[model samples]
Target: MANHELLKLTANQVKKGNYNKAILAIGSCEAHGLHLPEGTDTLVSYKLSCMVADRVDGLLVLPPVTVGYSGHYDTFPFTITLAYDTVIQVIYDILESVLRNGINRIFLMNGHDGNIAPIEIAARKIKEKYPDARIAALPQWWVTAGELLPPDTFEVWNGLGHGGEGETSIVYYLFPEWCEKELATCVVPDHLPDKIEIKWDFAELTNTGNTGDATKATVEKGEKMTKVLVDCVVDAIKKLDAVNWDYSSTNAASKL
Candidate 1:
């Protein structure tokens, strides 16, 4: 059976039950090297949320927030971003509106790295206002695809990077036709001196705007990685629903 998606349901159907948990997928519209599409983050994150919704009962997947805080990629064409404050306000407002409908359990699945700080800030502020509500936000990259996959599965890149091996592999598995593997190449930034903090741009990193060895990506690895990712998300949702502890007495009562 197909999972329930908020955008696909009617108002009457949505109001007929006590569905308290919801998923809000957040991603970005920005450059992803030469082979991957600009919509890579949004596509992968939204799809992953949908997969989780199908497995976990009473979970409704919200339409994804495709545009995120990506000012660092302004040099690239067709990239869009929201101001930090704007993103935070948007998240807070969305959560408030969701609360109005009695859906207090929110899993914020973020696919963009740049939106982490704003999302965390918004989550904290929301908890301060709505103690009973639970909001959890995490970047999908933190899943550690390398560790999840078999030890000998990959040869070049072992971690997630911008349009790198991990991201490219997943994209290929999900939408092979959309992936331009022929153009995929390896490009990483030079090693930096320890403790040398500096502001840098994608242009300064590599000539192709890529940050990892995309040439090593394969569809088989992507499939395995995606399976583990889905399991992780399903486990998170289950754990969130299983919590029975009361947060009524604590200032940090909001459970992610």
Candidate 2:
């Protein structure tokens, strides 16, 4: 059926009321480093979204949200970010659209750290509006972060920012030609000493505006990370209990 996500659904998949669940990629279009393109965030998020959608038959896939909240990355030249409120609106709008389509379950596939807040907000709001809806917003990395990379590469200090080894690794695996192999340097950000704030306009902290080492990133590691994370999300969905205690369908529908 041409990959669930890419499939141009016929009226048949539409009328069976066959839609049971869906995976939405909440990504961002912004700069990473000199080497990586601005859409790295959206790219990884989309991969995770598709991975989850491919599993568990009744799930439909939605296009990735290419623009998301990224306030922390505005200092960079090509970095693009939406205000906190605007991003919240985007998420809210998308969730409503999916809920209207008889989709009771939603998995928010997140790739950007900055997207954490708005995603959380949207999750909560989705629940409030549609009491029967089951929505989970989980960052793509949080699930398989441990299993994907070596313990030594964790780099607890500088990971809070953008365009780091973690992100680069994912991109490298998906698109090796686009990655710069030598960008991941050992030098930690200056803010490591302060230990208060690691990312943002604190230009003095970063020697290269990169939090972690992108040069150390490898396609192998990224591939492993992607698999781990994707598998984790699919596992979580399967493990979930069916419609907790209450059996009611709110027949409300929304349009995109």
Candidate 3:
């Protein structure tokens, strides 16, 4: 039942109904930290999407988009980004193509933090085209880190730790060898000032390119966090499906 071999197909087969409910994993190729590879977002998206697909029935996990927005990290050489409008068009075009195949349901599993705006725009436009369309996306880190990591901390090291601890642990659990424990010692910057605009540049935050105290991360913690996130997602999907709002309840549309 966990096999995705039969779930995702080529555009040709998808047009022929060879798939079911669809997912598009949006990720980025940006500097994660000196400890982790630049491909961290892509790798994580693929693994997490597969985990989600296994839990939900009729979910067809699409191959992840390895390249996504990294304008904030553009100062770092490897980082790449797409303009918000351009990405919106790309996603909209994709949904349109999928809809042509008679599949009306779609979800975007966002891996990069910066992909949010464009993805939402695409969702809104797609819904306008097909009233029955159900579209959603979430960057899994928001769910996992928010739940597991306690807020109170004496460690400023922890403050520098996003890529260091939370992200590294998730990767370690999924691909052990690729997770370098030695590199876990990367320095987390404390004196960097927060700017009004979103700082897309990883190097600006720290010379070592780490945000969190990754030394605290462990495989055990990752396993627990992953379970919690998957459970929450499953619950959310059920609740949303049952929301059954009466369109006539409020004349908000009529006022328009």
Candidate 4:
């Protein structure tokens, strides 16, 4: 029952807690679909970050970056998009601030696909400046969830796509009130090749602002996804803590 959220803790509590690691959720504000909320990405990532922090000792959950680059999804209404460089700078600044607070073991939990490149760029910049900083990231939780679960867990497009079955299911489990299940819909892009990566806009993929079989989503699937994702992060953090966040073979070789 220890307080792990930086935003919720007092300075005295934080000092007493002596947290050495932190998590920052990077998410986007965009149209998930007619059924899901606009802040679906942020809500999901932030909630997962909280879940991870709750189980990990000495781990602090920092305030999330709620709005990320969503230019591709701007064809839909009310999408907040940041320029690529701006997104990079924002993430860099946040990470820099976290490092300044003396917590160098950082974990980034990202929720939107558009922010992936920016997160990488920002993390690289932080590493270049602070080589001792041990940073880890779950850049694509959606993909990770699918990989962790059984193949048949999701009934459509492998639970892939914006506001798709997997995404909707998780939201439904975590924030069911935000979802209008009656309005849920999907548009699986059958034309796109399986092997090649296509940089298509959201408009090109689906007219409904979603690209998966959302109707197949359910609370049970969401609950399962949440557990696996949280467990995955918690286990990884414990492993990192076991070595004092020192995974460098060079350091190990020196001891040898």
TM-score of each: 0.89, 0.81, 0.79, 0.96
Q: Which pairs clash in model 2? A: 183-215, 184-213, 184-214, 184-215, 184-216
Q: Give the TM-score of candidate 1.
A: 0.89
**Listing every candidate in turn, what is its Cα RMSD in Å to the true structure after a full C-alpha superposition?**
3.8, 6.5, 4.0, 2.1
For residue 229, give model 2's deviation from the true position in Å: 0.7
lDDT of 4 by residue, 165-251 (tens): 999999999999988999999789889997899999989988998889899999999999999999999999999999888786854
- Those runs of model 1 whose alpha carbons end farther than 4 Å from true positions after fitting are 193-198, 245-256
Error of 2 at 57 (Å): 1.4
1-256 per-residue lDDT for model 2 (tens digits): 3366734566675555366788888888766766676788788888777777777666777878888876666666666788888988899888998888777788788877778888888778888988888887676464347545467644543233456666677787887776666555543554355537445453554545465666566667677778778777787777663534233556767767
Q: Give stretches of model 4 more than 4 Å off.
A: 250-256
Q: Each candidate: how many clashes? A: 0, 5, 11, 0
Ranking by TM-score: 4, 1, 2, 3
Model 3 score (lDDT):
0.67
Task: Give lDDT tens digits, candidate 1, residues 1-256.
Answer: 7647888888887776446789898899988887988988889888888988889888888988888898888777778999999999888888888988888889888888878888888888988999988877556553466777777777764645688888889899987888788999888666745569557777777777667889988898788878988888788778767764233454766678
Rank order (by lDDT, best first): 4, 1, 2, 3
